[model samples]
Target: MTRPRLLINFAITADGKTSTVRKDPAHFTSKADLHRLLEIRKRADAILVGRGTLEADEMSLTIPAEHEPAKQPLRCVVSRGGSFDPGHKIFRSKGGAVHLLATDPRPDYDPAVYEKSGATVHTGALPDFLHRLRTEYVVETLLCEGGGSLVRALADLDAIDEINLTFAGHTLFGGQDAPTITGALGEHLPRSLEFELVRFDPQDNGECFLTYERKR
Candidate 1:
């Protein structure tokens, strides 16, 4: 059996902030990074994102026309409360499959609505959900495009195998409150996690595309 691999792709500022001072959180990546990001998504078996990311970005989560939409990866969303917007474009696509995971016992959602729109709903523990993806769906490569909270949760669980981080050379200093990529690493990471740098490409916007493989 092929071991499941969880790969996280995100961008941060030079100061390690994933967002800017505006607190809106969209200025972390450059155009070049965006292109590479799409390319990576095209190669994966499945793509996963947190609910907050889905709501905030309103992402279509589809591969562009240059790639075959039918060949695109399965899109999955993790929401504890099953609070995803049914009208989102990602759900509108009938060509690809969509899966929604919620922890709520009686989720306040209409499963038929999403099913009609071409999405499947599942409920279970997060780890078990991922395992099912690997075993049932044959998802060997899982890509995580996220809001910080989801990324942190996955990191805490040690489920991630690799991280593709792009650092934009801009600073978003001084905010009332903002989230960082690493927030308060406690005893869970005592000796500090180690990674091997894989790629570094400089963009016109002074952003650096960096990739790292986690040391097991």
Candidate 2:
């Protein structure tokens, strides 16, 4: 049951959609918000992103020297096939140990891609995989920068501890097909996970930053 403190961070449009139906990059949030993200990243022992997110944003997961984290936060990705472009920046980036969680085994899975890139691959169910993260990586805190489906999986498992969201004002990617912070719930049941709004800061612009903690 030893698990890292899981934190999910994302930005959405005024309409609550994380991205357009095309799943475009959400670069709409302010620069201040980007700095805020790095601040949070500096505190985490590892930063995780889903395969979809990785495909969308070739995230390097490197902490800036100004933040001065004792060491680089481990760069981690979650995917079933353990697939990544060998030339991806995460592999070429200096600092940060690269760790990949192959959450599912695939008939056509190729582990050599990750292994050749110097990434440690862990495989299994989400909950058990996270527990192993704490034991093996000493990951006391893990930050999730997402692509919705992974966040959905964590929420369904009731494993997330905190959510940090930035709502951008005056922007609307209004499409019923667009993605939100959580994608389609794998289960059909309607479940309400309760969270307390711990912080709410509205900026001069129409945007606001929000923090929520799961109710124990």
Candidate 3:
């Protein structure tokens, strides 16, 4: 079970929703929170996200100058199918090497288009891909920024090591179909994994930042 040390970061509304039913970009947090995110990003060897999150956030996946990061983290995206848009912000931006993990490749999918755009595509199940990141890429710390289903998959695998959360109490996206950190409203995880809160920072702007480490 060798893999990178996994960390997940998310911002949730007062009602515990990550996004609206329409799955809009998560821009409701403050400038401070954005700074917080970049600060946290500075600690990772690589940053990962589901393809939907990468597109929805329009993320460049690069460490900005303000952060004065020692180095830009490798930008990684995972998609069930091999479909990826070469025009996405991550592809256009200058960052550490880009990697695409296609857990399920379709017969019609071609990896060349993505390879031409300067990405290395890997095909496998999630756990195997994660192992490759650890052994082949030397990724010691892997940070996962999410779209709920991806997070849910990691949860099912019990691969998450640390959880970072921003609780935005000022906003609420209330809808039965809205998604939470793990995903859609119903159904429990295969089993319970316990974590203990290790950090809690309450800001004046009605946002609270919390960190939890798995209680293994």
Candidate 4:
């Protein structure tokens, strides 16, 4: 049960959609939300994302110099298959060590390929990988910037501690295929996980920032 304090940061449209039906990059929020995101990210020892989200966002996964963070957080990605592109921006970016967790074992994928690129590849269940992050990497705070499916997995494991969200009321991506914070309109989580709203900050730009702490 020992693991890092898991945190999720997501921006949702008025219709509660995280992305377009095509699963586009989440750029609907304002500059303030972007600033808020980096502020939240600064406190994490590591940042995690599903491969789809990572690629969609084209994230460099590094704090900007202007943010003045003490050091960059480790960049981590999870995928069912270990098929990451070597030319991905994350690999070329200068930041903390990269760690990839391929939850599903595949015979054709070679971990050595990524190792040669300086990324540590891990295989196993999400819970085990998270536990390893805490014990081996000493990650006190683990931030998950989502694509939803990954969030659902964490929720199923009851591993989430804090949820940070920005409600962008000005935009709406209403489509049956559009994804929500948990994922595409689908089955419920294993069980209801209760949370207490700890922070509610409404902005003048038709947006609201909210933070919830897991009630446990």
- Of models 2 and 3, which has the larger lDDT? 3
Looking at model 2, the pairs that clash are: none
Model 1 C-alpha lDDT versus the unseen true structure: 0.75
User: lDDT by residue for model 1 over 78-146, one digit each (tens)?
Assistant: 988787787787876643489999867354576777778768889887888888899999998999887
TM-score of each: 0.87, 0.93, 0.98, 0.98
lDDT of 4 at 161: 96
Worst 10 residues of 2 by lDDT: 183-192
Q: Over all chains combined, what TM-score does candidate 3 have? A: 0.98
Quantify all predictions' global Cα lDDT against the true fold. 0.75, 0.84, 0.92, 0.93
Query: What's model 2's TM-score?
Result: 0.93
Candidate 2, overall lDDT?
0.84
Write the residue-wise lDDT of candidate 3 on 176-214 in tens digits: 999999989778999999999999999999999999999
| 1 against 2, candidate with superior TM-score | 2
For candidate 2, write residues 1-216 as lDDT tens digits. 689999999998888888888887677778888888998898899998987888787678878898777778888889877666677888887968888787766877777777887888788888888898899779999999987888888887787899999889868988788888887423542578999999999988788999999998
Positional deviation of residue 52's Cα in model 1 after best superposition, in angstroms: 0.8
What is the TM-score of candidate 4?
A: 0.98
Per-residue lDDT over 1-216 for candidate 4, one digit per residue giving the tens place of the 0 to 100 score: 999999999999999999999998888899999999999989999999999999999998889999999989999999998778878988878999999999885789888878888999999989999999999999999999997999988998999999999999999999998999898889998789999999999999999999999997
Off by over 4 Å in 2: 184-190
Q: Which sections of candidate 4 miss by over 4 Å?
A: none
What's the CA error at residue 187 for candidate 1, in Å? Answer: 8.6
